[model samples]
Target: MTEILLPSDPEVRDRCARSMASKAFLTVWEGAVRSGKTVWALCAFALYATRSPDGDFLLSARTTATAETNCITGDYGLLSLFPGAEYRTVGNVRMVRFRTRQGEKRIHVVGASDIRSYMVIRGATFGGWLADEVNMHDRRFVSEALNRTAMSHDRRHMWTLNPDDPGHWIYSEYIDRYEAMDAGERAELGGFAHFWFRPSDNPAMTPAMLASLSRQYPEGTPFHTRYVLGMRCVAEGRVYPFFGPSCVAEPPEGVRAEFASIDFGSVHPTAMGWYGRSPDGAWWKVAEWGPTAEESARMTVADYMDVFERETERLGGIRRDRLTIDYGGGGEALVREAERRRWYPVNPDKSVLDGIQATAMVLSSGALRVSPSCRRTIDELSSYHWREGRGETVPDKVRDDFADETRYAVSTFIEPRIRRRRRWSRT
Candidate 1:
């Protein structure tokens, strides 16, 4: 026997209760991490299914794997979160077949990464729809998914996504544009509603944990702006909003380890960042050199190396082999130069999203900090943001040399160490 244990968070409860009682065609939950919105979504999905047992619902995510991980199978999985819930997948199809008060229910699972994925729902009709990471889906898929819904009055939708650049369609198309229109406009565009949340909304999160999480992202950083305060205030495209005053502390007195990260930018402005790791596992930006555009246009590998070595010495000395340079095609020359001089080649993790995500994760934990002197790094991170129109959000290539170098260094050096400690803690 399972029980539906909704969070006491009023916003979550009110939003979910609204979905259950209201006839609005769409209900969206947008907010910060651990806010219990997802739990609300699961409840709404189940309640909707029960009301129309003969109805078939459609559920999706960026991918089927993610759908399961985020909902059905993850630690806080929805399947087990509700009591007396039993489901069976329908054959080889992407659906979870179950029985509820209405009689028979089927919740179809699909991935909406591309337009082609829409074929999964082609010609079929849905009683309800639930989409996770809706922002990641192609517009065509989303449109098609909506079209596949059954015409019954019970048909409804629930969507969730983290905050992205304001330019994101989630804001322009859904939040303000599509919903909240006048009766005539909403009647023409379709009915919809939304709710907002933050980590503080989850009472299960202890005060100490919240403080630790708060420390990870100093105020004014994008992570803090979105995840902590739950405001859509971060500038549309800036990537590392976590590099401002709160994140910049005076150079710490005890730096347990030292290393350097280099992004070779001849003409584009090469960046070298000296980082120190303390016993507390925080990574600090101790020193950096991000030359002016004009200077980088002609600065040679040797010129940058001279500055790099001096910065290393000033930061209490890092082993020469630990000096890492980017090996991505654009930085090959620098990598070659470093190898020639016995320096380490920091193989750039080509997955731009992964590196950015890693950087954000570190910042959210307050483990990534910067020195006041590393103005270049701070400036770059402050402005680095996702570029729109690519069908995907990637950090704009411009004004990101130091940002890239810093992310590569942290993902390469700090994340691995953090993971090891986490693994050890379980034992």
Candidate 2:
């Protein structure tokens, strides 16, 4: 007979229970929406709380409402999985506490509206920490909440989150680095161990739920691909999936563009791409000139200045307010020197993903056109490949020089309002 009781799957429960007991620094459960990530998270911590002594467990979510709705407390009927537990509610504090016979475990369902709430975890030791929907949590939680556990021994931090694309902060910090490690990255032990599963991995899922999901979301849809299969498939990040060499743009004659972006490489060729906005609100990549044989022969700053002066004259006397440079080591000084020669020096706001997204939106919308003079930029954009596996692929360190330059190029000259934020603060 099928097990009709709540938390009926022993394998799922046992796997979660064992991971919590192992006290690994990071235990991630990447699963589909209905694959029982929440159930496994609670069962694991509750089971550990029952087995261990003098340790606390925290159940944190993006908000208190989600915490209550997701059944982190006994009121959600999920606590029925642990029949031997008693729940006490303190209405004044809006908190719920659970106790098992082996040892008492307190579950704090804290809301994260701001960074201040996370400060409470400082110097607080926990036997188990359950961060639900961790991807959706603010970026501040990592430095505040997780870092505070550095001094604790035998403590496990468990993450239960539905998979998001590469743009998310947690995916970049944890999952990205974990994948970058080589076979021998960890000595005497092994590489960081991670596990991913879907609702299909669990036999407990009902046929009705599967059919309902299929009917509600079509194949290839984000919801279906993300929530139903729990696969980390991000189609948006793969811009220009089928682009080829035919669409490369050529430089135009009678150039009136007054702005350019400079990527100064002292040893490498100092590179720059010139641009101008058309009447229809499209950006035209008019010219791209990097270190020629003559400019690359020397590493002196005067050599860079000479090349800059030539480009400035070639572009019909560049406006001193329109030049942008990468905020690299010693780049500010180069910009200052260029400014001394009456060329503008500018620096883009540092937002990698958002800036990339803005440039992509323009490119896909046909609002960005590349001139034939910018041949290397076009070639690099074409060859920029998405990293294999999942989440944000480490920008290829080798073949990504031109791609990186193009990203910086668009970030500097693309005057998109959404990408630019006006900062104002009250005194």
Candidate 3:
């Protein structure tokens, strides 16, 4: 048997021990990111599979790639626990084959990203199931997965996830229900065990790492509240609370205007921004333009194109490849017109939460700044608030035209470069 070194954190060790000993039908480890929950859950799953009932096991994530990366091949994942384990793909199914006390057992890997994911596990019975980032999976897939494991003798399931909004379906349906149940009620339904972990619980995290994370997600912010404190809370108030006088500045000298991003609209204002990069690699929003509601209603695609060409010329002409535009709403007409002129505009990445987080990180790190002349952009920054009661953290859509363009420019262009630089530095 291979020796497994456990974290020194007593709480983590105790939870891992309890997970193996518990007679729970469902076990959940939920909390902060990199909080050792996945490691603990994987360890418990390894133990469960050794003696679990007479059926194939299931291992899943929001996507197949994620399932493979986080659960099977990650540094602290299942394959690490079972050294020399064989992983293979047969037809549509990806699985890991490993020796157990009973015999060789297989764990099928699947992704439950959408409603259609339920079809992947429809008729198959599973002895046990282990899910990573269960909150990202569709509710229908989660329901179908649970049903798939109903016939096993153990019928146990383990789940791990970072904290999401309090009103999320996973919380309202499973976590809340479990917490609300009386001790007798829980016992009567086999059992449901839950564990909470904070970053401090992860023995692998260095003090410096914790400090860096604290800086990345500042205090009183939604990211800080959920990720650092490991709390499920609603996101309210200003979305970019960090944007203030420090973030607004005159365009720095020797800045090269690199690209432009457009948030096209017909009913709402059509917004655009010219972004530049300084010698120090910092990003600056040098200029912005948008038609008023009245002007937007009267402006045709030709008018918008003329404005785009004039603005591009004023900025010394940006490469067509660097231009990004929102493809939704009335933007498709603008995109087609631009293409006819041989200006291929790339579609912006419209992932709201991720874009917001990346934008926040850059702004907070002083890597992003906006010219004081961009009044509308600055105004949107101050007024952009989270949409309440949506059961998810989302920026309110009203008056968000400039905000959307800024997100497109930063997230689509700058954030990936920053991530690459970070990765390179680590390597």
Clashing pairs in 2: 249-371, 249-372, 250-371, 250-372, 251-372, 251-373, 320-344
* Each model's lDDT: 0.72, 0.60, 0.86
Q: Which should have the higher TM-score, number 1 or number 2?
A: 1
Q: What is the TM-score of each candidate against the true structure?
A: 0.68, 0.49, 0.92
Worst 10 residues of 1 by lDDT: 81-90
The reply for model 2, stretches above 4 Å from the true place, is 1-231, 234-242, 245-247, 250-255, 342-344, 387-392, 418-427
Query: Model 2, clash count?
Result: 7
Instruction: Give the Å error, residue 29, model 2.
Output: 12
In candidate 3, which residue ranges exceed 4 Å CA deviation? 1-5, 86-88, 99-104
Q: Residues 1-427, candidate 1, lDDT per residue (tens digit)?
A: 2355555867666665775564467788887766667766776776667776346788899988888888776445556654444545566567666666656667788889867988778888887788987877878888888888857556778888766656666677667676658888766555777777677666567888777667655465455666676666534455665456878887668773377788786546678888787766677888888777677777787777767767677767777666667765467877777677677666755457657767877765577888888887888888887665643456678878888888878777777778898899979
Error of 2 at 150 (Å): 12
User: Candidate order by lDDT, highest to lowest?
Assistant: 3, 1, 2
Candidate 1 is scored at a TM of 0.68
lDDT, candidate 2, 343-405, per-residue tens = 667776445544555455456545567776676777666666555455442334344444555
Residue range 59-149, candidate 3, lDDT tens digits: 9998889988888886767787777788899788999988866888889999997789999999999998999999989899999999998
Best by TM-score: 3
